[model samples]
Target: MGRVAGKVALVTGGGSGLGAADSELLAQEGATVIVTDVRLEAAQAVADRIGGAAVAMALDVASEAAWQQVIGDIEARFGRLDILINNAGVVVMADCEDTTLEQFRWVNAIMTDGVFLGCKYAIPLMNKGDGGSIVNMSSTGALLGYPIFFAYSAAKGAVRSMTKSIAIMCQDKGYKIRCNSVHPGAIETPMVQEASGRAGQAQAVPDGVLPAGAVGAPSDVAAMVLYLASDESRFVTGAEFVVDNGLTIRP
Candidate 1:
């Protein structure tokens, strides 16, 4: 318990799925959590349930003004920011040939631009206090080509690369903030469920397709996120950790 005792974490998109799991885990570990999402009511609900030491805020990851506001609020309320989980993302799948400019820009704005803004704004807060950890959520699609998800893949790929750039920049600037990205493959979340249902298929990860036998739960990804957000990975940075249940390397 208390793996991150005395720390404060800001989890974007904390209203649902993996973000919700991450927020709950961080609170359980004795860290004050800020559950931020574009959905204010959803964020409030999660924060209220976590109780003890949690707050809710409307954090639109794609907005620079919102980012600034959240950072300032964290500073005023928590005195310092220790962890920034850049988990807010959106995936609008369209074939490259079918991809519209609006569709492409929308996904990239949130997935890639949001990560850039988070790291850019959070680094100063982390540098001001003890060095903090920033965990950006990418996907296995970023590493592998999924013909159905052209824009999402591109945005996530950009997120992965952006993570590396942030890591190198932090090292050069002597900022103690460590940046890394998480690549989850076919995790069981509302989004994935929606995808599967849209496919009208009962199975998400079939036996031969996924070595794990089934899709992973949000908690499966939360465990890894906690480790990254905690001091356990004090020296890890610029690395992309894949929690795909062997989907990435399965034959």
Candidate 2:
């Protein structure tokens, strides 16, 4: 227990799926977690489940004002921020040829722009304390192009790139902040399930997506976030951690 004892963490999209798992585990490890999601009720549910170690807040990641308000509230209440997990995202399936500019912009607004805003606002606050860990949830799609999820892949790719840039900037400036991105593949989450259904596939693997005999759970990704959020990975920054069960590897 107490893997992140006394730390303060803000997890965007903490209402459900991998975000919920991360929030619960971080609290179990003794961190005061702020679970923020656009869906206030869902975030509240997560906080209620975590008891005293968590609080639910409403945050529209695409809005800079919302980000400022939430961060300000965290500073006032917690006095310092030690961890920021930019996990809020959406996956929309549309071929490159069919995706409209509006669609692309919207996807990037949430996945790409949201992370940028979070980092921009949270960095100075994090620097105020002992510095902090920033974990951005990229996907295997970021490493490779998925024809059906073109915009999602593109946005996540930007996230992967931006994470490295932030990591190096912090390192160069001598800040103790460590920034990293996580690439998850075919996890059994609602978002993945929705994409699978849209692709006319069952919940089970559709051949080439997930490797044979490979399966993933929210806890799989959450465990990696826990390590990154903790002091155990102090030397790690500008790195990509793949929790995709070798799905990105080709024979």
Candidate 3:
């Protein structure tokens, strides 16, 4: 049952949806989880429910100072970091022609810049002991043409590319750390629900974008995260794991 036993794992956006599921699952499998979100109460609520070694903290991923503080705190308390889930993100439902510069910057700041900062700061700590795994949450949006999610797609694309770069760099340096990207499609998460609600639909994708019965649950994605976080995936790095239920392969 202890897939990640004795490990310390940090999840960004751990307050709700996919983040909450990831935190709960990781804790259940034996990691001391740090659940961080911009919403303090929400992150704390998730941590409280998970109990055990789970803790919650407020973190604005867009801020370098916040990243520094959280990583420093983790190092002080845990003495080693083992896993990182860079899953904080925001979606703007604006097409390229209609997206404002501010909106684009905001989405990239959280999703793209956030992942960069998490890896930049956490890697040294991870190196201090045994190197660990970094899972950057990308999306099907990064691989497909979603005109309405212009900024989100761009940010996720950056995440996908960055993951590969980090993976290779660590490999070359002989660090034990591994980096990978996860691409989820139309998962039933709060972010997807809100984006769908804005589009006046029951699901985030248009009727034909997702194949029939292809919608996924948060556990589906969390399972993938678990594998990546565990030693089971030790040989896996710089890879894109798609949890889209075959949606990415549709003709």
The C-alpha stretches of model 2 lying farther than 4 A from their native spots are 198-213
The sequence of per-residue lDDT tens digits that candidate 1 reaches over residues 1-251 is: 99999998999999988999999999999899999999999999999999978999998899999999999988887789999999987877679999999999998888888888988888898889998899999999998989888999998999899999999898998888888999998877777877767442334433343445468878788999999999999889999999998888877
Error of 2 at 106 (Å): 0.9
List ranges where model 3 is wrong by over 4 Å: 198-213
Per-model TM-score, in order, reads 0.94, 0.94, 0.94
Taken over the whole model, the C-alpha lDDT of each candidate is 0.89, 0.93, 0.94
Better of 1 and 3 by lDDT: 3
Per-residue CA lDDT of model 2 for 198-236, tens digit only, reads 433335434444555476888889999999999999999
Judge candidate 1 against the unseen true structure and give its global Cα lDDT, from 0 to 1.
0.89
Q: Which stretches of candidate 1 lie over 4 Å from their true place?
A: 198-213
The clash numbers for all candidates, in the given order, read 0, 0, 0
